[model samples]
Target: MPQPMGQTGGWESYPLNPAVHPGKKVVFQYTAEMEVKTLVFTLIDKGHE
Candidate 1:
């Protein structure tokens, strides 16, 4: 899913695919006019480890 960013906001969070498995390559893209300051991948496991 391509989550479009607003012009005024500096941060946003996009929901990851539930079917996403390990070793999958997720691509994050933005427009040329948009400036990317930082990128982070967060994984939260609430189930049994």
Candidate 2:
């Protein structure tokens, strides 16, 4: 499911199900009223630590 970023867009996070493995490709679809300058992705270790 895609979540809306709302009118005031700053930062939003989405979790990947089944996780992403090596040799896999992830695609994102974004719609914004204004021009998008930068997009960033951060990986978090949810495994046993």
Candidate 3:
């Protein structure tokens, strides 16, 4: 099941899908009126070795 949303943060973006490689730091614009945001993701595991 999907976890709760707001427990996290403002906006979010995950990997396109399960990826073989680790994650990449992501930053994008929400709206021109709003400020840009940066998200850094660290791959803890690949669904267990």
Candidate 4:
């Protein structure tokens, strides 16, 4: 089992993959840079898991 690095804004704490739970995972985080549209894409990519 793996523990969390720390608290995050929910999605950032979700498992990179839930079913397999391989523990091999990829994490991505980026600032909106005050751009809302760019943040949308970042969230879209997160759902690709």
C-alpha TM-scores of all predictions: 0.41, 0.30, 0.27, 0.22
Q: List, residue by residue over 1-49, the lDDT tens digit for candidate 1.
A: 3455665324455656658643233344454466655565554443523
Best by TM-score: 1
Per-residue CA lDDT of candidate 3, range 28-48, in tens?
323333443444554445465
Models sorted by lDDT, best on top: 1, 2, 3, 4
CA lDDT of each prediction against the hidden true structure? 0.49, 0.44, 0.41, 0.33
Candidate 2 displacement at residue 18 in angstroms: 2.6
Which pairs clash in model 2? Answer: none
Better of 2 and 4 by TM-score: 2
Give the candidate number with the greatest lDDT. 1
- Candidate 3 displacement at residue 30 in angstroms: 5.8
Judging by TM-score, tell me the better candidate of 1 and 2.
1
User: On a 0 to 1 TM-score scale, where does candidate 3 land against the true structure?
Assistant: 0.27
Which stretches of candidate 3 lie above 4 Å from their native place?
1-9, 16-34, 44-49
TM-score of 1: 0.41
Model 3, residue 20: displacement in angstroms? 5.4
Candidate 3 at 17: error in angstroms?
Answer: 6.3
Model 2 alpha-carbon miss at residue 47, Å? 9.8
Runs in model 2 deviating more than 4 A are 1-8, 21-35, 46-49
